[model samples]
Target: MKKYLFYVLSFFTLFVYAQDRQLSLAADVWPPFTDIDGEKSILSDLVQEALGRMKINSTIETMEFAKIFIEINSGRFDGSPALWISDEREKYYFFSKPYFYNQLILVGKKGSDVSAASFDELSGKKIGVINNYAYGDFDKNQEVEVVSDLSNQKNLENLLSDKIDYMLVDALLIQYMLTYQLNDVTEFLAIGKKPLLVKSSHLALGKHVQNAKIILEHFDEKIKEMIADESYNRILELNWIKADVDGDGKMELVLGGNKAGTSAPQNIYGLMHDNSYKEKNPPQRYYVDGKLYETWDNIPNNYKLDLVVDSTPSIEDTYIRLDFLD
Candidate 1:
């Protein structure tokens, strides 16, 4: 009996040690997704919190984009929470399942037609894109002039100046602006209903890092667990929720709110908007009072209470509105 107890205690000790493992990670200074010290970084908050729930601690340092991989490969960092897959990068890193996505949606001057089924439809249009960014199949349409440049800020400046007909930017940035910075942003920019491109993002460990594969596999499992318990939505702190809650083999747009609102989300946001999704008016579900309602129509009128917001509220306001300008 004493021998069996000794083995059980030893197993528990090993389990505790594994759970307390720490990881040193790195990411670039990409706003709305990655920020210095994780002040305003959504992905950083989500990844860090997700790791914490998994009983794994992590520290992610923000650096220049070019240096993120270089430092990881040199063993200065163990891994990165933000990673995009490529043949060259796969050589040095073991990637986790796609935990996040970098989705690019087209933007145009207010009142400009920002509708297109594909890049082929936008032939002859001059579009602004960030330099060194990989836009899937966007280059195939040679007729559309891609004005690649230094940054999104430069592109926005050019777009407002009418230097480019349209600009491609990450959808998360659009959501952030709509929530926190949209008061000035919406006056000039009209966003496309569909995304131009979607890049799958992963948590990756350097090949030289110890227990790289095991850590990645465990991280993936914890991500799904986080989503199931609604902690993922809390981490995002935004109204958009994407998950296959209905188990329909397709994802649904869900709104996180105290009350589900009076109707569907006017401007639905996606974590990764599948390029193939061609629905003109996709439906949005709402989470209210800890219950998931399939639609606003099904919601009881008593539960449709809206959070009052001043029409001209402070920019620091963190409240969410179901209505969004297209």
Candidate 2:
């Protein structure tokens, strides 16, 4: 009887250890977002912090971008910290709330004519862009000649070499590279004032992983908590200060830091900042009720009913339930 009890106890202990094994996350050498050798990046840090909050241990496996996708989809690694949602990807993975915004803009040589008021105007122009990247509506425009490259570095290099007229690149990526890696290259390029496209990035988990849904929920909850506690701001080194900047009594989110001299607060969130408000400043961040929105036009009709101030429905009505976080 004593021998049988010892065997049972040992088996249970081994089972628990196996079940609590650290999860593996696949990533690539995407700078600012991820750096394999350095084991640092905004997304990587955010993921680690969220997991740590949940007391979950994990390891990041650096691999090629293509292989990262393939392996994660096959359940070789648990999931990826950064991924855009698509019909194909949704089939094999569960996505969490957006952790980063991918705002894309155009870059060209100094003194070059990079003016293209619309996509149609870009016809017959050679525009360099990252391959397999979704540039929102720009992807549908077949008129412009898009030169695809493997990475942002390659696309930027092509731009500098005059291989392409203008390169469509992520704002954050260019900002990081210019600030850290390629400061000397700044004098050669001109960045567009207006953004060309914007997309939100999410944490993608393999559908086959055990308790994937629960894990996703917990991760998302931790992200919200991080944002509320201003821990997220510290990670990014940006002060997303929340206060009534417009003196409307309701709180507004302003993006700035104490290091830089403060500028006029931009009312980017809520319906008050919408086009219907008739204010000069346009909406920066869009959201409605309980759900955060990528664009004003994408907000649901049900929410629009209560948001219409003059009984006129406009696509620019933005109002996120700030109380929801409380």
lDDT (Cα, tens digit) per residue for candidate 2, span 1-326: 99789757654553454368766898776666765644347778888899877777878877777788789877789898888777877888898876666666678877776565467777777898766654555756787888988777777678777889888766655544443434344457677755565666777889888767667767777776666555765675444433233344443453332221223334222211112223344444432232334444554544333211132212211110001110
For candidate 1, write residues 142-206 as lDDT tens digits.
89998987667778888877899999888777776665557666777788866777888888889
Misplaced by over 4 Å in model 2 are 1-19, 134-139, 177-186, 241-251, 254-326
Q: What is the C-alpha RMSD of each candidate to the true structure, in Å?
A: 5.9, 14.3
**Candidate 1 wrongly placed segments (more than 4 Å):** 1-21, 161-163, 181-183, 246-248, 252-257, 272-276, 279-303, 309-326
On the 0 to 100 scale, the lDDT of residue 59 in model 2 is 82
Residue range with the least summed lDDT across 10 consecutive positions in model 2: 317-326
- Candidate 2, position 65, lDDT: 74
As a TM-score, model 2 comes out at 0.69
